[model samples]
Target: MEPIVILTLLAAMIILLLILGAPFKSFKWIGTGAVRLLIGALFLFFLNTFGGIFEYHLPINLFTASVSGFLGVPGIVALIFLDMMVVN
Candidate 1:
């Protein structure tokens, strides 16, 4: 689809939601998930920065971010383990 068409549809949806008043619970859940994803990405960024010294680098993408965000430190460790044992 065209960019303009997608934007128009998105705008219409937003306006409709505003008029209809979206559920507070859903918004809260979405906000929490978004924050977690951001935190997860930050974790990966720091890891890459320091791990670079050890030649350790993990791609920052949706799957990794989600795992780290939702599962926290253990998730990062697991990814590292997988990278070392499987990828190599």
Candidate 2:
């Protein structure tokens, strides 16, 4: 797309959002979910890093991250158990 066209569309979107007001609830939900996902990723990273000595690992992806993020430690344990069952 042309730069001018993109700029115009961006400006229009900003104006529309400003006129309608931002959705605080949606933003809060999204922000919370994003933070959880980040935390989940960190959990997995540490798990993999430390668990490496024990020869354990779990793939870091959306579903796993969501499960771990929303469910916390239990989620990671569940993933490990599930991986064991599936892989073996």
Candidate 3:
């Protein structure tokens, strides 16, 4: 019932589902996008502090948003990776 316990359980479930390649939809592309969206939203909302503690905001900001608008999804991925590594 604790938040940490719930998060651990959810994370474990996702790991299991991914490893098993459990298809969530009949469509492959849609299913993959749905999974990524769910996982990203979960982490972004709950774990923003993990990135924030280091003043490491994802390039989801103004500058990168412009780049993202031009470069699309790959740009966002680069932003995410940069944010993740900023603290390390």
Q: What is the C-alpha lDDT of each candidate?
A: 0.78, 0.77, 0.56
Clashes of 1: 0
Q: Compose the digit string of candidate 1's lDDT tens values, residues 1-88.
A: 7645644664565455556553687686665676677667777877887899999899989999889989999999999999999999
Best by lDDT: 1
Choose the strongest candidate by TM-score: 1
| Per-model TM-score versus the true fold | 0.72, 0.71, 0.38
Report residue 43 deviation for candidate 1 (angstroms): 0.3
Off by over 4 Å in 1: 1-23
Per-residue error (Å), model 1, residue 31: 0.5
Name the lDDT value of residue 52 in candidate 2.
93
Across residues 1-88, which tens digit of lDDT does each residue of candidate 2 receive? 7645644664565455556554687676665676677667767877887899999889889999889989999999999999999887
Candidate 3 lDDT over 1-83, as tens digits, reads 67577568757766765776635546666545445644554454353457678665552334554445445567556667775
Q: Deviation in angstroms for 14 in model 1?
A: 22
> In angstroms, how far off is 43's CA in candidate 2?
0.4
